[model samples]
Target: MKIALVGIGKIAVDQHIPAINDSPDWELAATVSRHGSVDGVDAFTDLGDMLDARPDIRVVSLCLPPVPRFAYAMQALAAGRHVMLEKPPGATLAECHALTAKAQADGLSLYATWHSRQADMVAAAKEWLTDKRLTRLHVTWKEDVRRWHPGQDWIWEPGGLGVFDPGINALSIVTDILPHPIHVTGATLKVPENRQTPIAVNLEFHHPQGAQVTADFDWRQEGDQIWMIEAETEAGTLTLTDGGATLKINGERSGTAAPLGGEYPRLYAQMAQLIADGGIDMDLRPMTLVADAYTLGRRETVAPFHD
Candidate 1:
C-alpha cells in the first residue's frame, strides 16, 4: 500500500518513519511538513500539494498535533484514502465524531491509534483482569517536560493537552484492561500561572460496578520519572510498572517485558486489515472521556512554569 505521511514532526521522525521502513505491506510514498524532510521520499510543505501529486496514495498517516488532525483526516478521507490518526484522535469530541461520520460516508478506514495500548504488557494486564472485580486503581505519571518536550510550545496552548499528554496514556490502559466502561466523575486541573491549560491534574473516575480509579499527572517533577498503575481487586493486587512494561500480581512478577515495537506499524497493519475487511476500528471512547473531563473539571491556578 502506498502511503503518505503528514506532519514530519518529532513523532514522525522517531516512530512513524522507522515503522514504515519495517513494514513490507506499506511504502512511504510522500511526506508533508512545513520544515522537515525524509530521504528518498517526495517532500512538500503542504499536505494538499502532496495529495494532488500522488493521487494513488491509498493511505495517509496524520502525525500532526491533535488540533489540526481533524482537518487533515477529513481531507484525506474525502479523497478516498484511508487515514490513520495519532493518539488522542482530535482536540475535541465533536471533531472526532465528525471524522468518524465522514470516513463512514466515504467508505474509508479511519484508525485512531493509542500508542500506549500497544505496549508489550497490555495484553498480559488484560488477561489478568479477566472476570476479576477491581476495587481501586491508582495511576501516578510524573515527568520532567523540559527534558522530554524541550521547546515544544504547543503543549502549553489551549488545545495542546498539557498534562493530559501523559494522562491519556493512563486512560488508554485503564480502558483496555477494565471490565466495563468508565466515566470521569470529578477532576481538578492545576494550570500554570502563565499558561491557559493545566500542567497537572488529579482525576477521579467511576465505573458502573463501583470500581474507583484515581490519576495524578504533573509536569513539574524533577529527576527519576514515575509511570505506574496499581489495581487492587478481589483476586489480588496487580501492579504494572514502567508504563505497563512489567506486570506483577500480589508482589509476584507475572510477565516479562517484550520488545517495544513501533506503535505506528501496528496501527498501519490494523488499518490495512480494516480496509481489506471493509470495517472500521477507530475507538474514541478514551478521547470522549477526556473531553468530558475538560468540560466538567474545575480549574485552579498554580505557579508559573519555566523551561
Candidate 2:
C-alpha cells in the first residue's frame, strides 16, 4: 500500500516515519511538511500538491494538529484514499462526524487512533476488569509541559487541548478497559491566567454501573512525572502505571510489558487487515467523551504559564 504522511512534526518523526519505514505492507510514497524533508521520499510543502502528484497513494496519515485535520482528511477521503488520524481526531465532534460520513460515502477506511489503547497493558487491564465490578477510579497524569512541548505554541492555543494532551490518553485507556460506558458528570478546568485554554483539568465520570471515576491532569508537574490510573473493584484494587506499561493488583506488582513497537505500525497493520477483509473500523466512543467533557466542563483562570 502506497502511503503519504502529512505534518512532519515531532510525532511524525518520532513515531509515524519510523513506523512506516518498518511496515512491510506500506511504502512511504510522499510527505507534506512545511519545514522538514525525508530522504529518498517525495516531499512537498503542500498537501494538495502531494495528493495531486501521487495519485497512487492509497493511504494518508495525518499527523497535523487537530486544527486542520478535518479538511485534510475530507480531501484525502474524497480522493479515494484511506485516512489515519492522530488522537483527538478533530477539534470538535461535528467535524469528526462529518469525516466519518465522508469516508463512508467514499468507501474508504478512516482510522482514528488512540495510541494509549495500543499499549501492552491495556488489553490485560481490559481482561482483568471484565468480571470485576468497579467502584472507584483515580487517574493522575502530570507532566512538565515545557520539557515535552518546548516551543510548540499551538498547544496553548484555543483549540489545542492544553492539559488534555496527556489527559486524553488516560481517557482512552479508561474508556477501553471499562466494562460499560461512562458519562462526564462534572468537570473543572484550570486555564492559565494568560491563555484562553486550560492547563489543568479535574474531571468526574459517572457510569451506569455505579462507578465513580475522577481524573486529574496537569501540565505543571516537574521531575519524575506521573501517569497512573487506580481502580477499586470487588475483585481487588488495580493500578496501572507508566502510561499503562505496568499494572499492579492490591499493592502487588502484576505485570510489566511494552507494546510490541510503534503504535502507527500496528494501526497500519489493522488498516491493511480491514481493507483485505472488506470492512472498516471506526470507533467514535472515545472522541464523543472528549467532546462531551469540553462542552460540559466549567472553566477557571489560574496563574500564567510561560514556555
Candidate 3:
C-alpha cells in the first residue's frame, strides 16, 4: 500500500521510517513536513498540497504531535485517505471520536496505534494472564525526558500530556493484558514550576475485580531506564519489562526478545490488514485513563525544569 508519512520529527525518522522500509506491505510514497523528509520521497510543507498531488497514496500516517494532529487527520480523511495516528490519538478524546466518525462516514480505515501493545511479549503476557484473577498490578515507567524528547517544548504545553506521553505506552499494555476494566480513582501530578504539564505522576485505579492497580510515571531517571509492569495474580506473578519486549513469569524468563525493529513493524502490518478488511481500530481505553488522571489528579508544583 502506498502511504504518505506526515511530521518528519525524531520519532518519524527514528522509528516510522525504518518500520515502513522493513515492512513488505507499505511504501513511503511521500511526506509532509516543514523541515524533514526522506532522501528520495517527494516532500511537501503542506498536507493539503500532498493530498491533492498524491491521490494514489491511500493511507496517511501522522507522526505529528497531538496539538496539531487533528487538522491534518481531518484533511486527509476529507481527501478520501485512510488515517493512522500515533499514540494517544489526539489532544482530546473528542478529536479522536470526530476522526473516527469522519473515517466511518467516508468509508475509510482509521487506526489509532498503541505500539507498546504490539511488543513481542505483550501477547504472551496477555495470554498468560487471561485466566488468572489479579490481586495487584503496578506500572513503573520512568525515563529521562532530555534524552527522549530533547528540545521538544511542545511536551510541556497543556495538551502535550507530559509524562503521560510515554506513560500511555504502559497503559496501552496494561489495558490490553488485563481481563477487566479499570478506572482512575486518584492521582497526584507533579508539575514543574516553569511548565504547564507534569513531570511526574502517581495514579491509583479502581479495578472492577477489586485488585490493587497503580501506576508511577516520571521523567527524571538518569541511569538505566525502567519500563516494567508487575502483576500478581492468584495463579502466579507475571512481569513485563523493557516496554513489553520481554516477559517473565515468577522470576523466570518467559519469551524471546522482539524482532530487530520492534513494535512499528507490527503496527504497520496491522494497519495493512485493517485497510484490507475495512476496519477501524481506535481503542481509547489508555487515553481515557490518562484523561481521568488529569481530571481527578491533585497538582503540585515541583522545582522548575530547565532544558
Query: Could you tell me which 10 consecutive residues in candidate 3 have the lowest summed lDDT?
Result: 254-263
Colliding residue pairs in candidate 2: none
Query: Model 3 off-target regions past 4 Å?
Result: none
Candidate 1 vs candidate 3, lDDT winner: 3
Per-structure clash totals for the candidates:
0, 0, 0
> lDDT by residue for model 2 over 172-283, one digit each (tens)?
8998999888988888999988887789999988888888889999999989989999999988999998888888888888776766365567777887887776566667
When sorted by TM-score, best at the front, the candidate numbers are 3, 1, 2
Model 1 C-alpha lDDT per residue in residues 1-307, reported as the tens digit of each score: 8989898988888899999889988899899898888999988888788778898898999989889888888988888888888888898888988988998888888888888887778788998898899899999989888987888888899889998988888888889988788898999999999997889999998878887788899988898988899999999999987777778999999867866564567776777888888787778777777787898899999999887
Worst 10 residues of 2 by lDDT: 255-264
Report model 2's TM-score to 2 decimal places: 0.96
lDDT of each: 0.86, 0.86, 0.95
Please write out the lDDT profile of model 3 over residues 1-307, one tens digit for every residue. 9999999999999899999999999999999999899999999999999999988999999999999999999999999999999987999999999999999988999999999998889999999999999999999999999999999999999899999999999999999999889999999999999999999999999998899999999999999999999999988899999899889999999867866368899899999999999999999999999999999999999999998
For model 1, the local distance difference test gives 0.86
True-structure RMSD, every candidate: 1.2, 1.4, 0.8
Candidate 3 TM-score over all chains jointly:
0.99
Q: Of the candidates shown, which would achieve the greatest TM-score relative to the real structure?
A: 3
